[model samples]
Target: MKNHNVFIALLHYPAMAKDGKIIITSFTTMDLHDIARPARAYEINTFYIVQPVDAQRYIIQKQIDYWLSEEGRKTNPTRHEVVSMVKLLYTYDEVIEDIQKNRGTKPVVVGTDARPYPKTVSYQFLREEIEKRERDFLIVFGTGYGIPPDLMATFDYILEPIYGAGDWNHLSVRNAAAIILDRLLSRNRC
Candidate 1:
């Protein structure tokens, strides 16, 4: 029996900009390969990219289809396995519905941010809690300055920002998602 159920979500709209404005960020093509690799490696059940734009969604779908193609499979067999886990969705609610349909339950929504905020759940605590419950989780990564306050308010838990050697806290969402999975899902890599 599987003891863990985890999903990854990338929120492109309803996110923030450096100027503290809410904006729709463009989807980064590299993130499909970069982030999906970590999601597959870390055993996440689903890698979801939530973008509402029609053109952006079309492009992402095409890319995903390519990765599922014979040429894509021949180009890099390993990445093909990873990309197979991706699911393109239009919004957060759709993600919930998909998980519920597949997993038979709604997932607890977890989020991450670069801002140093108190009352954030520690990675250690979250890992232990996940081990204790038979619950599913949707861990969301923001596309810009991080998901805005209103969106953050909807998360069941928000993980604390990861720190580097200096005061630098900003990390590309792809890198941040990878680190979060390593810290929370795997044998302590630190």
Candidate 2:
């Protein structure tokens, strides 16, 4: 498994390239401060908010257990890799408030893995609209019970869901964050 200390260090310094690109990592895990760090980094940020009903210690423990399991060990490998592998999870309301607080004139927020799928479209359209207006982008994902239907309706996009090939869902979030960060960084190079 990833060394907890290394994961904490990455959270301390989320890689930000010279261009105006930002990557935020989050999960259904215990470190809220780590998740919030990225939000503070980007003028545009993404969040994974968990539903109130599912914000119990048991769920967090489950995530922790998954992190320590054999597959988790394989995925994280070492402490230096944990920050790159997992996201710091947050409560739904906390995410919304953070977005509202950090959202500037040009901000986009995406709620991924939402039900009904249309929310994803909304996020895309919102991005287009924000670009048209020359605004920033802020995206949010839902964890635990997932985003509510009403909130999902307002998302700028819905991330394509990736079912684990027999692994835990939490791992999917970590992998997604890494992929997203890679894409964002690559595009920024141009």
Candidate 3:
């Protein structure tokens, strides 16, 4: 498929904790590698790591910097390629600003969640929407429990939950991202 103006934003701040309190989630190093791989495979424009904490952002930036360095590239060229597409930012606003600055248009923010919201759209509908490619698309994924309800209300669309054959639906952010991307961009019927 042709490269789409699609970006992935993995948010770590203002996420809902298990206790229903808003908290900042820790950035996972594994998510950086796992999410970027499928994103690159699907020809996404960029993969953004959104963390508000300075320490967390710094740690992720260090890893990104190393991966783009000569030694890291020499050690793992494949990883270097994927890491090159990751942009670490301090807030969700920065993500939108960066994309707007680069793309000359604000992206259509699509939120991913484990539960269906009133604005939830099907995978097939979203697939058709992004395929239009009239505007940039930013697929947002939350860490910890999930993005809070108030924040989710501002998103352009919330994708329907990825259900399985049974009632169980919890999925790792990385796995959900890969599955969601495939469902939206894959050649086969979803």
Candidate number achieving the greatest lDDT relative to the actual structure: 3
Q: For all candidates, what are the clash counts?
A: 0, 21, 0
Instruction: Tell me how candidate 2 scores on lDDT.
Output: 0.40
lDDT of 1: 0.86
Per-model TM values vs. the true structure:
0.93, 0.40, 0.96
The local lDDT score (0 to 100) that residue 62 gets in candidate 2 is 63
Q: Please give, for residues 57-153, the per-residue lDDT of candidate 1 as tens digits.
A: 9999998998899999999898889899999998878998999999899898888998745447989888887777678988989997889888788
Q: What Cα-based lDDT does every candidate model obtain? A: 0.86, 0.40, 0.91
What lDDT tens digits, residue by residue, belong to model 3 across residues 74-107? 9999999999999998899999999999889889
Clashing pairs in 3: none
- Predicted structure 1: clash tally: 0
Task: Please give, for residues 34-84, the per-residue lDDT of candidate 2 as tens digits.
Answer: 443343232223333342333454564465566568886787654223333
lDDT of 2 at 25: 30
The 10-residue segment with the lowest total lDDT in model 1: 1-10
lDDT accuracy of residue 100 in candidate 2:
51
Q: What TM-score does candidate 2 get on C-alpha atoms?
A: 0.40
Q: List the RMSD of every prediction in angstroms.
A: 1.7, 13.0, 1.2
